[model samples]
Target: MLKTAAGGSFIIEDTTEVMTPDQLTDEQRMIADTTRDFIQGEVLPHDEQIEKLDYELTVDLIRKAGELGLLGADVPEQYNGLELDKVSSTLINEKLAKASSFALSVGAHVGIGTLPIVYFGTEEQKQRYLPDLAIGTKIAAYCLTEPSSGSDAQGAKANAVLSDDKSYYTLSGTKQFITNAGFADVFIVYAKVEGEHFSTFIVEREMEGVSIGPEEKKMGIKGSSTCPLILEDVKVPAENLLWEVGKGHLIAFNILNIGRFKLAAGSVGAAKETIELSAEYANERTQFGRPISSFPLVAKKLAEMNVKTYLLESMVYRTAGLMDEAMREMDNSKPDAGVVAAKAIAEYAIECSINKVFSSETLDSIADEGVQIHGGYGYIQEYKIERIYRDSRINRIFEGTNEINRLLIPGTLLKRAMKGQLPLMEKAQALQSELLSMVPGRKIEGTLEQEEHLIAMAKKMFLMAGGQAVQKYQMKLEQEQEILSHLADMMIQIYAIEGAFARTKQLIEKRGEDKATIAIAMTEIAVHEAFEKIEAWAKDILATMETGDMLRTQLSILKKLGRRTPVNLIAKKRHIAEKVAYASKYVV
Candidate 1:
């Protein structure tokens, strides 16, 4: 029995065991394969032309994607969708991301722009809008950002004045930098109502006084259509209101959460694409009479890129599997279904935010490295890395900037702590102790349990000090957003490690120990590394807040105490790359 911080035992098992490819269901593999083929056969060929904003060609391809069941993956079958689980959706997004900025357009349309309606729309709204959206009859867009509110999407000043008869709301405002703006048939617009709360409305393109301005030339993702949505006194019927009035934040937050996971998945895709490109180029482009990939520095970069991709892949599917399984435990058919649904879904926001932060940063770093390996050829537009570099830039900025996500990370986890959503720190510690007993390695030594204790302490510190911290240390908190960001990442990795470990235990019981060896290796590496990171992050956090030299002394002691087993990462990465290459797909 696994005990939590509060000292209760649960049936949850340690999941740090290894898994093999045969462990994945056929459905999972099929969706991943189909997505890979789509990118290689379809999008890659037309990428350059699409980057030029070939609107007609892009729409045509989008329609083709609809026909291929690439769009509306998460929508229910009753609503003209495959009704695939979140894992499938995540896998698709990861593969698409390999195409780089093109993946951003795909993600925005399928994830942020369309998912709100799928999750929260009325039956009438779903019937009227989703079939076309699912089948790509109409492109979809989300209009939450305004010229004034970049990060504060809820700060929408676009006012929707209700008519005296309560029949319609006249909306007149502009939503800026909207993806698929010029091409979408429908939009989920956020606006403020007079004497009421901020709300979301379903605004159709055929409505009166609706138009899209010229596309804004962006720093990246040129293939995507982003423009300002001009709603000049557009009168929307009261029935067009999505979900309940004043609950627009629900739609926004839930959809954005899913978007974060998909973004992580997509970034994994981009990283894989970048890796393949770099690998091929390295083998062909020779320097010092050998392929550039043969150089130690280039080799090191490729290895690191592969490691990052593998970790991202592990985190994404693991999170998706958890989401899908959790959703299955709920009743999703009630009118108030999404409320309970939100509870279950919202529990994983920490995971989603972590995926967003780590995957985006990994993609950015991988793209830069790919360019460096290309040795000047990477700078030229002739090389794909230049565009990939540009396209990868906006990922960290959008889908709730990493800054906002960082705060949400600790904030969300703290909420879960209060609600007992996670087992108490003591329970988590007991599990750690049990794992250490089973593995019995030097990596398990040196203040691991203490580090976990510090994490719990940190959580308590934040809770006790958070309000006052915000008031007295607002500027300091803002400046240390990076700490929150790193802590969020550490939390995410910890969750993934824990969950994956539990899953591995299940596999071992059902399929025997031999079959789970590889997963065991992966989990061991992941857990130790994650522990080190969390240890470092927690220490830094403590040190950062301290005014005395005691922090430095404590951190130095902790650091010396927590030494780990050295991994032959190069060998592990090569092994991973070979498997992915053999499948000719993104393995994670």
Candidate 2:
């Protein structure tokens, strides 16, 4: 029998239930409204001051958010934290994106900086740090990237040596691009122990010889602290060592997984805000005696922005649902709870990467269109979209660059298939057999039928391209970064198509087809656009990987699978545009 949801399971199974904003409980909604109120009532009023990098003001805002229990969602209650579910935490971040730079500060502290202790700290360590960190009395920063290491984390040159009496470890390292460095009271620093084993240690800012470099003048997200931490033989107590020695990869990579997901949720929030700003601007900005929103060309941009964001929002929350489910039974008090939590979160590594890459790109593209919609005013700093445009650029680079994430999507799947943890090989084999007898243009039935069939074909397209790639390259497929990236694109599109389709179905189920008319239109547009990209990428992969009769055969199968029922995106987009324009905000 097929199992319940797991990482990358959507490729094999149909998702019947998903968590959407519509399904959020009243309490979760309240948390969001509270955060929204805080951002609007407190943060935005200080826009100029924040933009000026007012350290005290930024830290004060974070402390206020902490007082509201906003920073403690991922922390367990035993440590004087809120211990909310993933959905609630996601909502908080999403609403917090109303202030982008400040959002990054809060996200870093709540996610990467502090989650290490929440999930991996010794009980004593948690007792010493969790309460203060949770309440924002003490800010925390993550230190992993070094001057010599960026994507290649293990290449870090930082090291720590224990004293002969074993009382403390003398840590020496420079941590690059550390968020909250200026105000962080605690630092989760990584160094190779005994000059060999990469490990994590909790370092205090007040520790002797600990220093912070001047802030980096960034192009955007400037309000958030971005500085380097200088540890000149800082003495970190032996008890401050996190988890076991040499297990730092577990902490670094696992925390990055959550960081990616939270970044995804934050992108969705930013993208939505961009759409709201774009829609309102297009409606209010007049062109040639008519509102720009009345123009079909401008309306089309609004529609695309609105629809793409809808698709991303669906996926972000659904992934959150998966995460919450995975950790539902966790016993945080268990001595091995950290290991257990890490394993549970690691299971969805692929999904988290997917969410990260897609959401970041979605926000970028939407931000671009938002600027275009704003015309020349977008270039001026006075406009919110200008700041948004700049701030959005950092997301792709923040939680592992999108290129790194793209490579991970397919590479991770192949690794799992080789270990029998995933059924990729089995499905690829089955797809090849199906291609022999499968006819092109087979019609699917029910609401959103054409979109549904396209999703099925997209999955087959992935297997066809992937199966041949694996057969040819074997273990060396890792070297084919381009082909692997293409395969990852297929996986992304498949997940995205299915995400939109599932959410639309839920909308129709609850509201009836009559009421979910705009949702269907948006899903149709997103599915069509995504499938077109999938077809192009598959052909690109086939051409690059094969030749002669083999290449021709693969293309032939792709053609059969790529047949479309012809969605009228122009009409659908116009309809969507009207919906958002009327509300002057992004709607379903």
Candidate 3:
């Protein structure tokens, strides 16, 4: 087990070990290759048709994926699933991202749609639903967001009233923006029981009064089913109640933790494809008698894309490893293994939120640059980049908008601190005294050592700003959304940079420095760049909280902590880009 703080203390904890992609087992690599091949061979050929809203073809492809056992990595073997580790499930999402909207269909079916039952359903419910869902014989859809409820999911107006005879619950509501609604045979619907208790129920598509509205004309992922699911007094058996009534928020929020991480994995995969597309196009398209990829500007863009993708990949796997560790520590021989696993995933909710926000924004940037690299052709629907660009937009909006996620990051950490799950308050108080007498000059070591020190300083910056903000606002800190958002940005940067740094250090330790040169270079670049952003965010946040001499004192401390000699990032990026360009893909 890695020595780290529980809950969200990683922001203030020194990380030493993190799982990297280079450590993937042979079986995991084979799974990834198989997924890549399936997408390339089976899905890419029909990408055009799928993009044109060919629902049947999309459904067929999904069944084909299920036949290959791609859809049930997280489901148990007793349910006809592979019952693989969390990393395997993440790899599946990463590779499926190459399939575009088709990936969304599979993700919705396997993630939010079916996981509710897998994690929260009774044994009978699991037996009834998991087998079909595992094999893709019956598709599943999750209904939580309503027309009036999105980020505020618990505020849904949907209602379900139990019948007088206690045989069934009459559900009446409309769930909007439902993915997989068009073809899903099973629906996990959230409603207020008796129009008072918020709850979840499993409703079959064939149930009376259960109907789906017309397909939504979406901005992207057109092939994936998106529509409103209408439940008009639909009778759901008492047995269909998932988990406990009035505790539906537990299921809803916890499942989203896994969904957010998997979504980040998918974003990494999509960003990788975009990087490849951009690189291949840049290499083939010559300008002024040379390949445009040869230009410094284009090379920089490709390098930056590779860097962000690599960083996101590192964070995703690191979080997966943490979840795996948590799961491993549980006594699986017990009957509550599923609940244990769910709690394990929830333990890193802060990390999940960070992954979702960072990876989504990273993919959006990559998609935008990919379009720019292709110039006029990129804007046209005929090219893949245009669709990818559109598809990337929804990632930030869905799975909880990045704004909501941003707030959740710091907000959750503070809550955990108060709850004693993390020693954040203690660390903050200690750091406050240290700040009063802190010295400026400090000795630095090698590149990686310097990055590690910078990360520690970044954490201190977070504690200072966050601690002051809490004291200033007291109970009203939630209303200071702007400060919370800035703190979230700082935390996100710290996690990304620290994750990449820790992974690269482990790679170097295991493979020797010579073998990990590119990893070192990428880590150096990411750390330096992220530290700059952290400095700026700290300044902005402090300016909001304090002014005049108090502000000057805080700024001086932040400046000292952020002080570092800048490296030739352009040269490092050039070296990194050379490797990616030569391979015509994301080599790092």
**How many clashing pairs per prediction, in order?**
22, 0, 0
TM-scores across all candidates?
Answer: 0.83, 0.98, 0.98
Candidate 3 runs further than 4 Å off: 1-5, 331-333
- Model 1 regions lying over 4 Å from their true place: 1-22, 331-333, 336-342, 423-483, 493-533, 547-553, 556-561, 565-588
Give the 10-residue window scoring lowest on summed lDDT in candidate 2: 1-10
RMSD of each: 5.6, 1.5, 1.3
What is the alpha-carbon lDDT of model 2 when measured against the actual structure?
Answer: 0.89
Worst 10-residue lDDT window for candidate 1 reads: 2-11
Off by over 4 Å in 2: 1-3, 440-442
lDDT (tens digit, per residue) of candidate 1 on 1-588: 212121111112233433222356799889889988988899889888888888887788778878889997977777789978777787788778766656766777788878888778888888888898898888888999999998888778788989999999999898999998878888989988873578899999999999999989888888889999999999999999888789888778887888888888887778888888787787788777977665666766776676566666766766666576667756656665545555556657777787888788878999998899888999998988888888888889888998898788766654554577655444434543443234323333331233333333333323222322333454466466766665565556555455445554556667677675544445545555666676666566656665567556545544543544565655655555454334433443
**Can you list the residue pairs that collide in candidate 3?**
none
